[model samples]
Target: MIESDQNTVITKINRSWSVLSSNPIEFKAINGEINPDDNSYHFAIPVVFSESEPMAAVALEISKSHAVNLSVAMYGLDASDLSEDEIIDVCCEMCNVFSANVCNSFSGKNEGNINVPNKLSSEVFRYIFKGSNLERYYQAENEHGRVVIYMFDPCNYYN
Candidate 1:
């Protein structure tokens, strides 16, 4: 096997794990224990693919504080699960807004840069991105390819 230095994926996952393990009361929402709202935020969940077709995509829904309204799916060699209006950004650090409280969506496609449109409402997002399933939600190996774009009520370890 090949061993390389630490990377961004590892960082995001590490932070996400901390988000879950820190306090069960805080991560209870992932287990459906608590209903996420405008305050609740989702961490971890990531896409696992490059410019190629993904094997599977998994998303964690938070009832308390979720950015995307309805789930979405992208297709083709160049497709995305993100909205067309939601802001799309990139990150080099670990645990970015991708999981915090901001009301948005995120992906980890490593082929090229994935851009969400601009600022589409959740309602428009549902209809525009509607598909069978999101191809870049979260996976095992590919999960690390994602980056934090937007968030809401996130738990910052820096604090």
Candidate 2:
């Protein structure tokens, strides 16, 4: 991705988070490894061309506490009342929404097809990203907790 495209992706990501949570979020570009904790939740969505070929993907790694807080904010439920499955569901929906937004920005209005978000283990996440070109890595945090967004060209994986 070029510099301007990277900026657009970051802007869309910030906008998506703002739309999702009422809490204020601060995003910063990060370097080095972006390994999430073992307890973190991982979700990924593919951005596909009209011909159904994946060109890119967006992956999200959010802390467990952040996921719970997001669920409480989204569903108006108490944290203690939220189950693990409920948290995963909410996070998956979040991944789907934001990844769609980012993919639309890349493929133009209504031109990109965003696949369903998949929940994965950290090991799987790392395996899929291995040897792929990481276009950007960003970290966002607020009172809720931390979230890491990874933008990458999956096409490079098969190169």
The TM-score leader among the candidates is: 2
The weakest ten consecutive residues by lDDT in model 1 span 23-32
Compared with the true structure, model 1 gives a TM-score of 0.25
The whole-model lDDT of each prediction reads 0.26, 0.74
Candidate 1 stretches greater than 4 Å from native: 1-110, 138-159
Taking all chains together, each candidate's TM-score versus the true structure is 0.25, 0.79
Which tens-of-lDDT digit does each residue in 45-159 have in candidate 2?
Answer: 8777655454677778898878887888888889999988999999999888777656655433345677788898978777767756676678887665689877776634322
Model 1 per-residue lDDT at 101: 23
**lDDT (Cα) of model 1:** 0.26
| RMSD vs true structure, all candidates | 15.6, 3.5
Inter-residue clash pairs, candidate 2: none
